[model samples]
Target: MALKAAGGHGGNVHAAARDLRRPIESLLDFSASVNPLGPSPNVLRALDEGMRLIRHYPDPDSVRLRLILASRWKLAPEQFVIANGSTELIDLIPRALGIRSALIVGPTFSEYGSALHRAGAKDRHVRAARQDGYRPPLEEVVDCFRSGRKNGRRPEAVFLCNPNSPTGQACDQNGLTRLLKEVDRFGAWMVLDETFVEYCHELSQLPSVSRYPRLIVLRSFTKFYALPGLRIGYSVSSARTAALLRQYQPPWSVNVLAQRAAEAAIRDQIHARRSRAYLRRERHRFAKALSSLPGLRLFPSRANFLLLELPKPCRAGAVAAELGRRGLLIRDCSLVPGLTPRTIRVAVRSRNDNNRLVAALAKLLR
Candidate 1:
């Protein structure tokens, strides 16, 4: 079977396990790029304590979690809009802002395009070239905003994912700052998705979004906090934009356990620090190991995953299938725009798991 699209996003081991009639844990999943160190103990303890609270509805506004985020970021609580996931906020933006046209930087997250489509908005994609290592052209985007495309009006909004998915490329702070100024000049909204920014904290633009009236910064606890199942995420923007987004979001979109878990997760500075340090060390080692494998070109990544260009004569789908049958699941990039049939993505996992993946590829590729 063809690998499901969206790079077979992490936590898909269940469906594959069911088909193989094996336990999920038996399958080594490297498709999703969650923290290999896993969730903080404090987060798990918070979840256990929150079990009793499930009988009651979650606070419709997620005031407590918002307060934690506000304190951490030094932003007013009014600047926040917590959501079930950043995906919810992505879909809500076009409708909430009544945007008719939007430009998306890609090949990045597929959800941005799908969400805009659902809002009945025009989607314009400017793909980053492989020759450029998939870095988005900030100058070109500024020009697009300043001068409307030949066939259409200027986009009312633009979407960008930092340390972008699938490709694992990110724009530096200087470049992003310049792009924001251009977006401001055009009087359009800029949506910066920083879901993977925790891994590369220095590059995050979270601190400046509140100052930019037309900029919205999206973040998630799923990857960094290892809370994908909880689906906790939020956005930071001007108070007016936050309020508008709130009006469009369903009440209690964030659940009781998720709120409690995230509340505890954010307080564990030790866990966050340790995770950062570990990822830095392990990602380098893992990337080096992947490099030694024949016919695989590993792309530079600041996130928890690496995108690999498979050797010629190797197809992503075929490789994904071969590895899947051996209980190792990876992302096949055939459907991800701007990628070739030989591209595949694998998450940076534990040393043992990473070695197993390398060995599996060694055997397959040889």
Candidate 2:
């Protein structure tokens, strides 16, 4: 039987466990690039405290959580719009902004295109070449905008995932600024997905949202904060834009426990610093080990995962299937647009878990 569909995304541990006929805890999942260190202790405490709030309705505005996020980013509370997850915000964007067409920078997340299609909006793509190490092609995007303007087919918006998914390549702040300026000149909106920016803080453009009237930065507690089960995320933009997006959201879109957990997660500076330092050290060690495997090409990543290209004679689907039989879960990127059949992605997990995956892969590739 086919594995339960994750809608083309990862982190479906439940589905994988059931398909493998094993306990959920028995599987080593390196498919989703969440923090291996896990959520902050404070978050657990907050969740416990928040359990009582479930008896009442969640704050429709998520006021307390927004205030905490505002203080952390030095933006006003009105500039924030909390949602069930960053995916929810992604779905709302085209509808809220009345976007008719968008230019997507790929090979990246599939949801952007899916969300646009659901809104009956046309979408185009400018893919990054593997020869360029999959660095986000911001320059090409600007050129596309300029050329599209001449052809009278300029897109109404641009979707860019910084420290992008699967590939793990990010555009520098300078390049992002230049691209935003070009988008502004074309009178188009820029939807910047900074989902994994916590792993590389310097590249984030969240704090500068107010300066660019058309720029919307999407962030998540799911990745860095290790709160995927909570499904809490938010966007930062000008107050006017935030209001417009809020208009499209249903009442109580964010639940009580998620808001409380996210509020505590953001306030734990010690946990954040420790998590970043641990990942940096562990990722370096893990990458070195994977590099020793013959015929595997490992891509440099600023995020919490590594993308790999298998040696010839090995396909991602086959390797993933073999690993899955051993209760190891990985993302097969063969079907992701702009990627080759050899490409696969794995999360940066704990030392023991990473070592287990490396050993499994070594034996298979040999």
Candidate 3:
């Protein structure tokens, strides 16, 4: 199956359970990189309280959620958009902008290219080299743009996932500012995916997007709040871009339960703070354990997941399959170019789960 199809593959929590001969309730999946600690007590309580109102359509406009997100980002309600998930908004981006050409950063999300193709986009991909550990090359990108200037051609959109996916490598604030400035100059829009930024406090680019006119930052409650099932995500951008996205809107795209749960989750400061503390500690321990294993090269991660390169002759599929048989799941990333068959990604979860993964692999690698 294609990587896009496989996305919803390993995370079929119940089905994966059945295959392993375990009760769904007894299984813990590390396949999905969702916050192992979340869907806070507050969000749970709100869902319980709001369960009776499911008959009514969600605030059709997602007015309440947008207002909260807008307020949280110090922007007007008109400058925010709520979608079923970041995936939906990701699909909408090309259509909303009517862009025919895009420059996508690879070894990242597959949806960007899939979405672009569906929108009839002429795709231009700059694959990040494993030799460079998948960090953004600002100068190379600028040079590419400059090289294309004589053709009177410029890309319409640039999809940049900060703390980039699969590799989990992030650019510092200075690097991002320079890249965004270059994209902004060529009249290209920056679609900054900050879904994993909450794991890295000072390094987050959410607040920085406020100062750029053409940058659109996408956020999700799925990864941070463990709300993937609810399908809650939103985007922050200029009033004009936000309005354009809304103008091409899908009606009541987000549901009532998701809206309420997310509204509660966003306000749950206690939960957010505790999650940060947990990731800060557990992620360190987890990364160290993975790196200490012979033949695994663990990259630095500001996100809740780590990107790893295994020793030669060890395929990611073989590793993922072995782990899957043990009732554990990790992302097999070899299909992504620039990543060898040895590449795999693991999510940060509870101590017990993380330890299980480390121990399981230590035995297998031997």
Candidate 4:
């Protein structure tokens, strides 16, 4: 059994964010997943203006941003609840639901478990076999819940990642809806993390949520909008579920600038369209580049990031350390079980940068 220590290292992103405060020009961070062509021109300009409003209490409601989101999504503004970041929202679900027990997709973003741990919940794993392309058997996942229930393990929370982390496979829409309905029958709250869904293009996200009160769809501007530092994301649920979450939402939870930037981003269809086009083209190109490199195992991915399983009997940590020394950073997946040090996750960056990574790996392996 691989040791699952305190997992959420927060990636190099937390480090980069910390380092940025001290002033630096460029940092090659394929460690964090965000849209390479994000925080569009319009939002950058709007942020310049919104920066001045830092003096007043940001509208506690984050009304404008929600309005824009609602308009684009064609949902009621009241249906959207913003947060510090999707992370905050993820953490909140485990909190607000009063769920003392949960299950998460293994080798996924560790924060899901970290949040459950902080909330004093028992976190169980339905490991996604790496050889299986890290695709959890949805049927098995559902069965885990059913069997657990029969065994008196009525877990209240099931956290899912669409275009899931570390391993980029996504459950089809029908599969997700079916899974949700099964879990709902058991009275569990299904938290769907769609942080990478933007990269999936036309994959349908209309969750069982529209008809079921137990489903919640979580999205973040951090990924596709390329605004991780701005810290903005929202949740979609039935009116009742939205209201329940609204009651717990912190006043002015989203700051003035993040709100303005997110509102502007949610409304900028051009940026959204262009980023999708770029990722669709670039992800395939990058994947092909990585596959041709010796000793690298590439998996199928429909997202902006690629989860790579490196040569066996190796420590991914060492690869990461070597890359970091060369000013290039990627995710070392050794900490997550069912994944080994031979596993690394890299984001699809600008074409030149992606080539640089491919070149770096080639040279290192040689």
Candidate 5:
């Protein structure tokens, strides 16, 4: 199958290589905001050992992995449902929950809109303004819920990406709690995508899943664990709610290697700590370097990527395309609703790669 771009989600190195007629390794991919440190050393060892299990079918229930997750979050095993990736869970949510309409908090991931559309559901957006640094407007969302009847009826669900992509802005737990209260009062489901939360674990709402029955928290081994190739992610909700999602998932969606890799990745605390420390230092250095470019507007980011606005007359598409020609890929956010035409996003990579991108941007912007 030809790997087509999924809602402009980035990390299309294969496609970029094919288009540029260059080897994949030659590209510096700042498009996908994955861990710069790569996967845990333990995950590599686990994959080697797990190769023997490929002949046998993977655990359809993902029992051991769920048990590990349950232990980590101090939740019941029944409250978790492992999947091929968080994207699978995103597609399943609207279908499983009978969500006919949703209010998406944007500008954020396109998958939410695509997933709802695929489910034949109507959706609307409550976007964060650029002037506000793209912080999720939970207040406006609550007002919409309290006021009721947006387009003649209430939304059955609300989708929010905490530490939201492209913008890299996040909401605090208090804000989420307030929003959840409003959602529950109006009898709506809240799907919180915490894919980027491993970088800012303190902001995660995963531990609050038990308290808010209407809340569902999504996580991934792809980002922090740097196992995007493995395609393992899971969702947490009340046991009853989790059962609903599980019924929609196809059998053996997560492979044995992904399951084993996730298990090893989760247990590697030392590596996790090292990865976080590296991102803190590197993201700061990178942001500072990018800020030096004249006529550039850099948004504050808690996550491992930075969102930028190029100088006037410079479109994100043009900048991204130019950078692509130089074998440096970035996310052009111009088409993403709620962002300006000059908007672009880049991942916080290794020191040398980050510096290379900074120098390239400086030269191009000059």
Candidate 6:
């Protein structure tokens, strides 16, 4: 079911339209789950202001941006580690902690496997069943962790993709808390990737990072703030863990423009409220519409995207290609580990775009 070498993290407008002879602007991308509304006006102003500082080296420490994030979370600046993107910090975690083996809950983002492998760690991917709507069961994960220790060895790290990618299911906080304590007993780290948690802030464990020394929470501005091009994300952990993550990072990993953009983006309360409100209303409307489509099984999601499993006779890659020819790009989830060829993922976008996508999908299904 692995359709291509690159795993199913979509939003590849450039590559999708490259050989189609179609303009990128003409493509309606329901592939990448990013905010349909923005690079906030606040971000635009910050980017413009950052232009004057391009000639100077960015502050390697990212002090100003960290301060802003700290204020929002009510945590000290030392508890946060800024990076080029969450990917950088993801890779850093295994290396910084000298992790030898790890457990990853899948099928979720491929980067966790790739990053851990690159850090020279052996990672066992435990699949979360589709029958359960792709949500990883906490009891199963705890059992696996405990069972592995019976061999006189245990994984040094465990990764959880909150509101997991490809399948937008998340673990309950109390369950996660109990699991965190279990991991603590074995002296292992729990890497909680909440990249899309901003869309559902009430589910976030970001505030608990200070309480759990073994927890490392990864967050990004790329999806929520629409600053993917700028590439700025940060990690939240205890001050000591944050320092270790920072130590391994190259100098000035966050550029001037990215830092400025994040600073402004975090402070844009008006846009944040609007984005959340819009996502809530539109996600419900879109989900209802999608549910009415024949032969499609839509998984529950709290993030700004939905995971769809098509009828048995259909395949996602083929459907994706058909939609692509019509300037609609979607993610074929067949390649993502733990998923079948019938699965595909699409972003929750604007009303018009969502309707267009539904129309296109409906026509193709017919």
Identify the candidate with maximal lDDT. 2
Give all candidates' CA lDDT scores. Answer: 0.88, 0.91, 0.81, 0.79, 0.90, 0.87
Per-prediction TM-score: 0.97, 0.98, 0.94, 0.93, 0.97, 0.97
Give the alpha carbon lDDT tens digit for every residue of 248-359 in model 1.
Answer: 9988899999999999999999999999999999899989988998878988888899999989899999999898888888888878888888888888889999999999
Query: Which candidate gets the maximum TM-score versus the true structure?
Result: 2
What's the TM for model 2? 0.98
Give model 4's TM-score versus the native structure: 0.93
- Candidate 3 per-residue C-alpha lDDT over 1-366 given as tens digits, one digit per residue, 9 for 90 to 100: 111112343466766666677776665576668888878998999999889989887887788887888787787888788998888899988998998998888767878888899999988878777777777665666666777787866678888888788678887678778888888888888899888888775676667566778899998989989999999898988888888888776898898999999999999989999998999899999988888999889888888888888787888888877887877777778777667778888889999999999999899888
Candidate 4, which segments miss by more than 4 Å at Cα?
Answer: 1-6, 10-23
lDDT of 6 by residue, 1-366 (tens): 112324435776777777678888998888888999977898898889899999999999999988989989999999999999898999888889998888898888888888888988899878989888887777777887788778865778889998888788888889988898898887889999999998888989988787779999999998988888888899999999998888899988899999999999999999999999999999999999998999899999989999999887998889888888888778888888788888988899899999998998899888
- lDDT value, residue 256 of candidate 6: 96
Lowest-sum lDDT 10-residue window in model 6: 1-10
lDDT tens digits, residue span 280-338, model 2:
99999999999999999999999999999999989888899899999889998888889
List the pairs of residues colliding in candidate 6.
none
Instruction: Report residue 175 deviation for candidate 2 (angstroms).
Output: 1.5
> Candidate 3: where is the Cα deviation over 4 Å?
1-10, 18-21, 208-210
The Cα error of candidate 3 at residue 139, in Å, is 2.1
Residue pairs in candidate 2 whose N, alpha carbon or C atoms collide under 3 angstroms: none
TM-score of 6: 0.97
lDDT of 4 by residue, 1-366 (tens): 011123744344446545443222355778777888857899998899998999899988887877877777777888878898888887777777788998886658888988898888899888778678777567777887789878998678788888888788888677776888888889888888888888774664644456777888898988899888888888988877777877777777888999888878877888899999999899999999999987889988878889887776557777776776666768777776777757788889999999999998888877
User: Candidate 1: where is the Cα deviation over 4 Å?
Assistant: 149-152
- Tens-digit lDDT track for model 5 on 1-366? 011122667887888899989999999999888999999999999999999999999999999999999999999999999999999999999999989999999998999999999999999999999889888899999988877755557889999999998789989679888998889888799999999998889888887888789999999988899988889999999999999999999999999999999999999999999999999998998898899899999999989999899999998888888888999999888888889888988999999999999999999999
- After superposition of all CA atoms, the RMSD between model 1 and the true structure is 1.5
Clashing pairs in 5: none
- lDDT measured at residue 158 in model 2 versus the true structure, 0 to 100: 96
Clashing pairs in 1: none
